[model samples]
Target chain A: MSEEVMTPETSQKVTKAPTKKVTKRDLFWAWLKWTTAVEVPVSFDRMQALAFSFSLNKILRKVYKDQPEELEAAMARHVQMFNTNCDWGSIIHGITISLEEQRAMGNEEVTPEIINSLKIGLMGPLAGIGDSVDQGIVATIPLAIFVPMALKGSILAAFIPGLIYIAWSYGWSWFLFNKGYSLGKSSVLSILHSGAIKKVIDIASIVGLYMIGCLSAAYVKFPIALQFKNSNSTVNVQKILDGMLPDLLPFALVLGMYFFIVKKGPHYLGIIIATMVLAIALTFLGIM
Target chain B: MLFKAFLVGIIYWLSMGRTAYFVSFAFRKPVVLGVFIGLVFGDVQKGLLYGATIQLLYMGGIEAGGNIPSDQGLAACIAIPAALMSNLNPSAAVALAVPFGVLGVMLNNVRRTFNSFYTTYSDKLVKEHKYRTLSYFSFLIPWATNFVLYFTPVFVATYFGSGLVKAFINAIPTWAMDGLANAGNMLPALGFALTLVVMGKKQYIPFFALGFYMYAVMGFSMLTGAVFAVCFAMISSLFKQHDDDEEDYA
Candidate 1:
């Protein structure tokens, strides 16, 4: 099953254009426009359709300069409801650009249906993987490391994480963008199915999980301020708990929340409100 | 004070505006925003401290599918400035940030709803072949709409709401204040736990347990923890590769 999925036939059927109209500068401008304005024109009806079309507007016009009817159709097609993870979704744009370029250069095989289906099919999986890797690891682990330093009055520490995120996003997205453009759609499938990407994701997951664990231990704070009073002496319940395990309450608190999420789905507002109310109630009862 | 508030509003717009999303994403984190907000208030260290404290609540704030769990940028932009003006403690500042974070989500929805207008307008431009004007409608005009949606509340809150927050904080009793602070501390767990769920690898949970206990036992710096994490991951993957190789041979 794995082998079948991994090995797609590597056949390059599309004939190369004798002289390409779409230049390197055109591709660069398309990428720049896509990256900058992808999220700006987002709406409820069509999340990123306008921005996606905006990125390709000039390029589509350039590609089909003589064929105004085709250009109009292409423009109309791109301005449909399109949404995905911003950086990882660049590959979709690259593929779209290439397919459009080919169709303009008169590749009859690259149908409009093919272009739309490829985009719709690819966006969800890429988004699922991209959101986890980008936000879960690249954006987060740095915060886990540097936030403590920022607390200790290091301003540079605060900026470093953001810088790391920016660099990774731009660098990786641009790389994928170029790859998608050069490799075209079929190679993208093979690349997605490859074991190397899977291994990379696995490694990243472990690292991300480990860092989150450390972050939870260091940051999540719940203490048992409760105590037992006797006539002769007073017993500190928190101290007794601490003797058994340092940060026991905090650990339990984090796990309890985790299980709550697991069982009840992500109704975060309720959880937050419940936590605040419970904390306040516990404080009132002198048990927190 | 008006000028400072206006500057803060602009910062909020820039961070939440989603213009050059990569840059804005980096700009929006409370810790980063803390420095800028602090600069406006003339105390970088305090701002950093406040921003970092509030940031803990949102460490795992993953906005998957363009749906934000909470608006951390809005939280920081409002709370940091108010905390700066009113001399609120770090934990209290965190407590203050939570509500605003929630509020920011509504504003985001509103911005999205407002942007629907542009979609129809773009269709009109495309029909008429006014391609040049369509480009403006796609980016600049929608961005300008966001400036109004994102910037005003922050400006008003900073300029007018700071005094109100100070008054409200003063009115609240000491016990409740302590409770709020305690709640603030506990809230960070939500972020971490949410990340765990999103990671969606139930089998790798042992790694999380290992990391948590390891940190609890020997409180290392985050950088040190990362080094250990990378090594552990690499070693584990190496073992997995061996297993895969054996399977392939079979």
Candidate 2:
């Protein structure tokens, strides 16, 4: 049994247990191994809690080899309801590990209550931030760039964006995990509070919206081949629409679909089915 | 075909809900699945074309708040294989894929509900200090559950349904197939519309208009439009930051 070192000034109890040996390499490896598994079998009950415990399995085993009660406590702490952005959520894992390790080392300040509260409190904000960045920005940028290419039948468009996103997300998550481990809990808040998070979200939303618009014009091809015969000259409806505005039908169809999907509140399947029926009817009647 | 379907079903299960990071990315999207299906059918180009067309139908289906509105991967797997086996046009394949996507949503819900039982068991295991067993409950059990859910339907459909589908396609009139193809062409508008619904707000409608005009009227390429959109995003963000700073000083 190693003696506990109490630092009065920092209020951090350092446990000098000889068996407790979790290196930085171990934390990184755990993150790589467990990031995806964290969401597998994610339930409404515990969310990612079980997977979190699994990720910290090795560290917990080493840190509390002699302290069975504490080991049990640590496992139970992580099994509570936890949900957050899957990739960015690894920061929580890193921070929790640090706290658990310290607690095992005789840090009375890092209680189960504190750890649980920190996790519950931080997850929502981190999810908000992570969703905005990962889904809104990181995911969207590559998607926006490659989607049009894919639409044009370019194979590279399909593979490149996904690969880049995977690589970028992997690197981003690894970096955040290390940061959380090194900075502990308090400094994580300072990083979040810096206002850059807001800026990223704002910029991402703008770009995402604009690119979608571009996608609608470039890819959505809805043409009405109907024309009216006039006394002097035959009028082409599609040509007239083209003269008035390029891709007018596509634009309107997109907006109508948007309104129907968002406000009309039919399930996506219903709308898809309805569109098929309407399309078939229109094509048969030569009205499309 | 049965072997391929089993593999695709497994791919769908792994990519959507199972463990493994990069593997999921490779198969989750229809475009990738299209390539795989094409490889299976010995027609990579047609598969790519079909997959891309189907992929457009789901370009906006972002998984938000953990609710996947449609299962594009499953749709691609089922649709591409069926279309290839039947010699149907890619456009008709998009329409054909929709039902499978809906069914996938239902199955996904069931999978989620069933997995909840494991969470309870995990709680008991932790209490019992059965630490090692947690990994099995967390990873393996859910995986097996997903494998069973996905593989069964796909295998049955592939083994028994292919000849029936080919006969059915052979029996259908040319006009009906054309109608279906037309419907498929029009369906993409719904996807684009859905994208706007998710990402567009009234305030940001101008950017949508800007993107549309730049491409539709100015005849700018998609790449060019993207560049302009990026520039606009940067400018707007900078101006907004300046305004916030001014408010702070005030």
Candidate 3:
């Protein structure tokens, strides 16, 4: 299967001027359908497959307008198991659309196998990179910066993080969608392998880590209620701890949870239940 | 009150319904939902406070591969109104949000399971070459299904559950309430800690320490923290680039 893909005949196709053209309007509608419907029909088995076919249904019909048999085959092909990070995976849609157009325009090298392989190949990496960069950095850091302001009674601040996220996702997804259409398969590999993206991820990690710290300090509360009673005076444990490190308990709590996740591997429900039980028990014992 | 519950139900559906996925994703944040939910309850300030507090517990709620770790939207929608109606403190409101957030993941699973029917339907449509009908089934039908799945519980909870929530709060001893609030405060750690795990770079743990201790000592605004963070990241990246250049030279 791998050798078939690598065979010289199937490697690259020469560009031909004669074509069934997909106009900008057609692509826009396709993208619109994609963005809106991508997750709507998501299932346990096929995932976004129905939505994937739904988005391409019109485009497929138009491209294979002269070939009804081909159009039906195309429809059947798309509604197979499909899932990926929505915005980042727009590139896959772009690539698929362009490839279908080429195949419709008589590019024999653009086989069904090649298209399916490309989608399968690209989705995982893009999903991994997209989820972390988009959700971990873009969606989160803004919330860290703005939610405090929202807490302080600023209505605009409440919407700003979300606004930034919406803008970034739409803008980036649309740009990538077009980039995929024009550049086809080669561009994604280049973009993925590029040092620029790595640098971006590195910087995002630093900024994200730092912001998580700031947020942790600002948010996580673990105040100790223990006190040392003496003949002369009572020493407040919380105040003494505050005097040494203002949010020491919170810091330790965050570290404890982080290490738990690292060791136990993200069993969040267990962690949450344990934390609740522990807090309630400590409160019962007058320890926190 | 019924009208408000209905509107809040719509908000939940809009946010979690997966329609216009990115826009819905933004709208679903507790802070954002707080604003809308506040409008329904006629107390934007109180709603924002409760919502923002709840938001902290979900700050790092990354829905990687479309599997939400918790449903912050459901948590906020259900808990905020109950908190407002009962006048629960923000910390206690956060505690109220947690169980609802966990419950929401179950609804998501059910919705996904229910949607499996569409796959078989879509396969038939393609075989029959009924593309138009397939498109409707793909988006609109599934979305309507989600409206039922996402909206009903929220509406029922908001309209009927608030009274129960208030009574439940009243029945609980003050010590238990205080403990719940304390738990609320500590729960934000889970979000941040989860984020640390997701960020997945052990070497950068120092930056987190720097940010935490810096904030602990200086206590500057988040924007100021961001500026400092960016600068630190840039300077470190510059050193990294220099090392890369030397490696190229070697």
Candidate 4:
């Protein structure tokens, strides 16, 4: 394997300007609480709006202490239409809170419209990237590789994906949040410009596809029991297929099912019933 | 039945609440649920086997964008106990879990619809500037909604439905049981099919072919296949980088 693991180009220079009253310690506490309880009160109406506001609750309170009307407005802005891929989306939360802090400290340039626009604008793009990388690759790869072992009755194997997931999700989320908080608005530009995140995903996907292939060959079993008697040779059809290409039946079965699912619409129940019927019919014919 | 009912209810409620991540990570899996149910019923090994078996049926079920294709958690919660009480093997348990998962999906829709009412109420609270009472709508109302949605059905089913399931299992003919087992055997293809649908791209066909042939023809282990894949990824990445360098100069 290649030894190169390219890290994202995160800007190191920390800008010290328009320092706010809300301490970093307080923000840290809220962020920590949010990590454990982000989806606690998840509802369809606000989606993750409640949790988003809840995380910034302390900062909001301190920033708008003297101005009750401003505090109410801030709270109201957070409770609006808000949902995103939670792990990567936490960075947006960090940026939003930092901007809010600056605005509350009477930064004339940082208006309420800018803050709302920032949240709304970033949510969609971030969600798209997060879903493709986090859900599509990171989550899928581990399950594909480890689930086979788990099915084979290894307790330790079953635990691997869950452990890896918790660590990966929390670790990246924490780093992104810190980066966004310290770097403020510029962090967004740096993250986008680096181009390293996309490369990493592309490479991971190559491995993901390969692993899915491995899973199919090993796990998706379709052992044929057909036989033929010709002259002195009583030939087993399954053995002939295996000699030419191992797991041919399983491979064909998977491809057939894949076409059915993708083209015929992904009604899993219908596919299952169809498979059951096929299995029973083949068994009845003594050919499977 | 009463004890199992209470347990299932608690697990279901947690799957939708604050500790949702934990529930999703550890408890929601059919394998884990089986072990827990087995411990409760004094048959840990049986539970483990059944749980693992049923888990394969729902292996492809993933919740993306809050849309649950199938409710594996609910399926596991109900199926494990039902299988345990009825003395049905894991394959039949899978056949049983399918409908429960479907029912759970419908209930999920109902929960989301019900939660919309609270969303409207939240809007009202925000307009009124009742910041203090906002927690009532966000935290209290939705939390309560999940409790009602999840807890009631699980509790009632465990208490009353187990006996009926046992009778149903008793009535199933031997050939039908064999048919169910055969279906169970074929189910993993659907799982792989689902994963393929998500990850499939024409450009990646070579990698898929390499993986399949490496394992099937060369008789390589899964670990070996992964290692080979990584090597190929690295090699391809380097070649691409070389091409980029050439383009930059040109």
TM-score per prediction, in order, is: 0.89, 0.83, 0.88, 0.79
Candidate 1 regions exceeding 4 Å error are: A1-20, A233-249, A252-265, B120-130, B241-250
Off by over 4 Å in 4: A1-20, A36-46, A132-157, A221-288, B16-18, B172-202, B241-250
True contacts reproduced, candidate 2: 0.55
Best-fitting candidate, scored by TM-score: 1
* Candidate 4 lDDT by residue in tens digits, B102-182: 677677768767766766676688778676677666655677777888888877878898888788777876556655556
- Give me the TM-scores for chain A across all models, comma-separated: 0.83, 0.75, 0.81, 0.69
- Once fitted onto the true fold, the runs of candidate 2 whose alpha carbons sit more than 4 angstroms away are A1-16, A136-157, A221-288, B170-205, B241-250
Candidate with top DockQ is: 3
lDDT of 3 by residue, A99-159 (tens): 9987986778899999999898888767766776788788988888788799899999999
Which 10-residue span in candidate 3 chain B carries the lowest summed lDDT?
A: B241-250
Give the range where candidate 2 chain A is weakest over 10 consecutive residues by summed lDDT: A9-18
Model 2, residue B115: distance off in Å is: 0.8
Task: Point out the worst 10-residue segment of candidate 4 chain A by lDDT.
Answer: A9-18
lDDT of 4 by residue, A59-162 (tens): 78777776678888898888777777667777887888778876775566888898889788777656655654565555655655666676676666666666
DockQ of each: 0.54, 0.45, 0.56, 0.38
Between candidates 1 and 3, name the one with more favorable DockQ.
Answer: 3
**Local lDDT at B138 for model 1:** 90
- Model 3 C-alpha lDDT per residue in residues B110-205, reported as the tens digit of each score: 999999998888889988988899988999999999999999999999889888998887888877777777877788788788777767777788
- Per-residue lDDT tens digits for candidate 1, residues A1-288, read 011121222113222323336677887888899889988999999999998999888988877777778888888888889998899999998899999987886778999999999888888768767877888889988888788888899999999999999999999889888778888889998877678877877788889888888888988889878888889999999899889988887778777877888898877777878888888899989998
Worst 10 residues of 4 chain B by lDDT: B241-250
